[model samples]
Target: MRAHIRSTSMHPSGNHIDAEVDVRTLSVALLSGTGRMGVHLSAAWAHAGMDVRVCSRRKEKAQQIVDALLSGQGYSTGQIMVPPHPCDRPAPSASWRLQAGRVEEAADADVIVLASPFHVMWRTLEPLAPRMRGKGKIFIDLTNPWLNTSAPKGPRGQTLPPIPKAEPQASVLFHKTRFNDPTSSWCHAYRHVFWMLIHPTGPNPRCGERLGVELLGDPRAVAVCTAMIKAHGFKPVIRPGGCEVAPRYEISMLGRREKGPDAPPAAGSDPDGLIGPFSASPLIAVDALLEKAARHFR
Candidate 1:
């Protein structure tokens, strides 16, 4: 399947598919870059040379991360710009950047990567979703929400309401996910699908630190995304579960078929888990993943 490309004048299904930017330079926004993991990912992207905007709820924390990266080993020595307070309004000159909020940062970004947890993403995105619709941007969701709780509700997000029991997936090795509704708005707005899943065999998905983008959505978009992610220091591969259900299948992998020691409790034999890390081989991982996922290329 090809990428559903469009511009400011056409919908994903409109007459704008022919003319689309093939992702030259990406303005990447990491939602909660102040946190440990978020900071690490932002630093990695910066180190890899992508124009990035790292945002956090607090200004100081965000600056702290940028400072550490600029002065620390995150970025190559003298290879990056480390400005004081990367997000000072009016846009100052800097290497490592900081953004006080996602809205402003997203305005210049081609791809916005959500580093916030599952429960937090909805609240974080609700106010911004409408403004982001048809921005022709790609959103990378790294939040692993428990299914019963934080799945997106209502398509197009016109209702933009969070579920009652929808809660955060605190760091624990157990507990099944509480999946919420699937009528997700980004499904259409930003053209999202599943990427990567937990394993039932050797290891789980490394908590929140998986290193590959297991694309399972649009073939063209996934292919394009793979090259971009590869440029940004991540292994990119297409996964088996495609169609629109890849995201849900990913959620399911975390629960049934126990994998590693952290597998969620289940009955005797729930089908082991899903497949292992699709991007493992580095040599043939991309080819293998794409070959398996190709069937869903509608």
Candidate 2:
């Protein structure tokens, strides 16, 4: 919708002069820029005065998101500069701009946030693990992996089992693999429960901006990110050590499939929506997570 492609040069040989922009334009490159979380993050960054570069398999989709950002907040008019000319491509004679290209964007992004599913992380990040590390970058993992089941344990009817292992151990942890087992009778026994995963958006609709996230990272980064996530009308929980306590802490916070734990009891029998853990949203859970994380550091 809005095009803001500027022409500049890169000094690859160190002899030529390419204009250096001010730090006001904090460079960002979104991997899955077309998704909901990606779109939201892009807008959030722009509102904070950061320059964002979103990437998608479909260049058209990438441009479309750019347009949405402009209309939603009325700040940017930047263009989506890519290859395979779709009429917007720079002319063949156009000079190369020194703006950090795609690879550099990935490697040097100030904050590399992952709002994608867990599998996406396992597939894509596992490969880029080497370059994704270092200082000044935040790799946000907003995926909740969960599942519930009943097992034959000593007494107490039935008990939850252990999930696969993970490392670094956040103050609050998450494990994904242990949820594959079939549902046990204990869960089915209380079948008359109603679980509604409704957004605070409620009836007014516009009042629904209260969404949050769970942050697990360095202390300073955790504090900054906690504030960052909260600014979006959501809660922020700092997960200490992040993956360190992953296996032991993941229980109830997230499920392998969906619905966190189970519905509240007062409703009775007919469990509604995705029945699982967390009566509150991820934002709240992350807050709870941060508390757990802080203890780890202590």
Top TM-score prediction, candidate number:
1
Q: For candidate 2, write residues 1-298 as lDDT tens digits.
A: 1112233332222222212323233455666555544554555544444556666556666666565344332112222211111234332212211121232245466545544444343444444545644343444454333323212244775543332334322212321112111210000010110112112111112223322233343333343344344433444433334333333333233322223354222111122222222333345445335545554574
Clashes of 1: 8
TM-scores, in order shown? 0.50, 0.45
Model 2 backbone overlap count:
34
Tens-place lDDT digits, model 1, residues 109-140: 66666666655665565556555555455555
Candidate 2 residue-wise lDDT at 40: 46
Candidate 2 local accuracy as lDDT?
Answer: 0.35
Question: All candidates: CA RMSD in angstroms?
Answer: 14.5, 18.1
Best by lDDT: 1
